[model samples]
Target: MNAIAFTDVSRSYGNVLAVDGLNLTVETGRTVALLGPNGAGKSTSINMLLGLIRPSGGRIELFGRPPEQAVARGEVGAMLQDGELIPELTVRELVDFVRGLYPEPLDLDAILQMADLTDLAGRRAGKLSGGQSQRVRFALAVAGAPRLLVLDEPTAAMDVESRQRFWAAMRDYAAGGRTVLFATHYLEEADENSDRVIVVARGRVVADGTAAQIKAKAGGHAVRFTLDGQSAAGLDALPGVSAVEVTGGTATLRTADPDATVAALYRGTSLEIRDLRLAGADLEDAFLALTREP
Candidate 1:
């Protein structure tokens, strides 16, 4: 059974639609990454799942129950962006305070060590840096050792080292039959860490699949060639070519029909093709293509 499921969910404020009809599912024990630009309804979608706000339409279920039911049962761990932690309490104290709310919670010391906060145990949560504050929230999120973990922009403010540590800790935690749902705009993080990625744009799911699958769907085939005397106008007339971007001596032709484009290009130009290469599709390339205007 899916850990989280949304079917035709939509949220609107006045005349502005934040989340359009959307369907998504996160299986138990898989880390599903949600990718989108700013104000793309990522937060609104998450808010519905977290029970912070009611959806304007459609239905959502978590662990086969409604959002409030799942949350009321203490089966969820969520760390939304900018959620405040007590400013005066030390890291240790904050973790302890959050831990006291759960019946069978994880050990505070273990969580601290896993989060690499042992060194900063004495540091006040309020005085900590942005990265440090995020870490504190992460510690609290896992303190209950819940079944489902939800994180929004978890490593946005983290440094290289801290981001690596956080990913490792997250992997360890999710390995224990726990599901993870993360929303972020970081392409590398989504590509490298997520088991699956659901991309949202304009309040709708633009793409959904594994990193490679989604990239492939976004059309990764690029034909790189150099034309001796063929002008930019001639290149744009090529059959099956979607776009022609030229710089220096190279022209990168992005096309869905690579064979047709290559045939047309050869017919149009006599320039010796030097270093003609096909660039494989990558997540970043795919994301840009998907989010780009059609």
Candidate 2:
């Protein structure tokens, strides 16, 4: 069964369309990364999927049921960007409280261990640091042993170590054949952690595939070499070159057809091409190319 489905989904606020005719699906047990620029409707899409707000148009389903019904049954777990914990409650208290709401909650001790809250289990929510608070939120989200987990910017306040631990925990949870869908600005995280990535722009999907496939889709390859006291002019005019950059004595040309670009470079440029290299585009390069406004 599919974990999520969105068909012709859209959301608008007054004159602005936050999500426009979005169509997507995720099968059971797959980890998907949802990526977009600011105001690209990632949060709006998540809100509607969680039933926090109604979609302005179209249909959505969660595990073959309506989102509200699935949520009511404790089948969906979410850690959003802005949810706040009860200030008066200790970490343990809060986690336990949320666990009691689910039909088959994970063991309290297990939840603490997974979220790495064992040491701070008794700390009051108000006394915790920003990163600590984020961990607490993760604990709450997983307390129910939910089948589908949704996280938005889950590691925003976390340090490097905390982020690593968080992804480990997430991977452990996902290893249980559960589905995970996360939205994060950390493109590296999406590249390293997810099975698939979906990039949105102007409130609609612009790219969807594995990281390698997406990178290939966005000007697939790069040709680089050292320029020995030679002009960098006319590099952009080369066949299949989308962009050209020169830093120090090195020139890098991004191209959809590296073969053509390299042939033209050898035939056209009088510059000495030293230490030449050809490689696939990285995720960051692909992201900038795809999201850059025309």
Candidate 3:
């Protein structure tokens, strides 16, 4: 069965539409990333899946059941961006409290080790730093031994090292055949960790596929080179070159065919090019290009 499914789902607040006719499905054991700029309805969609809010139109199903029913059975665990840890409770205490709410929770020691919180188990929740608190939240999310884990900006306040460790733990968790759906602005996170990426723009999904497929939606390859005193005025007119930008001695070209563009450049230009480089679009580049206002 699919882990999650949304059929023509939409949500609105008064005159503002947050999610518009979103149709998506996530198979069991898949790690998917929901990527979008601010106000792109990522949070709205997540909220609906969590049963925190009702969709204005269409339907949503979690593991072939209503979202609320699945959640009630401890099938889903979520770490939202805005919740706060209760004050005065120690890290271990907070985790224990949440674990008790579920029928079958993970072992306390294992949870602590997985979240890298064994050292801070006795630390007061309110006394922890932002990154540390985030880790505690992660621990709580997994305490229920849920089938579906949902994280919204899970590494927002974490440092580089913390982010890496957190993802490692997440990878381990998902390796057990659990489904993971995370919404993140970090393109590298989506690129490196997620098996699939769904790009939403203006309350709708614009692209959905593997990381490479999403990047391909933006265009082909980017060719960059530095050539002193060389003009790029005619480069844009080259076959396979879609756009060209020249700044001082540096020229950047967006090309549908990198080999053809490179051959045309060599055949037409005599100026010696320095620092020439060819690279395909990464998630960030594709995101900006695809979501740019037209």
Query: Whose TM-score is greatest here?
Result: 3
lDDT per residue for candidate 3 within 1-294, as digits (tens), equals 899999999999999999999999999999999998889899999999999999999999999999999999999999998889997999999999999999999999999999999999999988999999999989999999999999998999998999999999999999999999999976668888999999898778888999767765667578899966866577887767888888787888997667777888888766576898998765556767778877
TM of each candidate vs. truth: 0.81, 0.85, 0.88
Q: Residue 104 error for model 1, in Å?
A: 1.7
lDDT per residue for candidate 2 within 182-252, as digits (tens), equals: 99766678878899999887778888999766666677588999986789999999998888898988898
Cα RMSD to native, each candidate? 4.4, 3.7, 3.0
Return the TM-score for candidate 3, rounded to 2 decimals.
Answer: 0.88
lDDT of 1 by residue, 39-113 (tens): 889989988999999999999999999999998888898889978888889999999888888777899889999
By summed lDDT, the worst window of 10 consecutive residues in model 3 runs over 212-221
lDDT (C-alpha, whole model) for all candidates: 0.85, 0.91, 0.90
Mind sharing the TM-score for model 2?
Answer: 0.85
- The lDDT leader among the candidates is 2
TM-score: the better of candidates 1 and 3:
3
Better of 1 and 2 by lDDT: 2
**Candidate 1 runs further than 4 Å off:** 220-288, 292-294
For model 2, name the residue pairs that clash: none
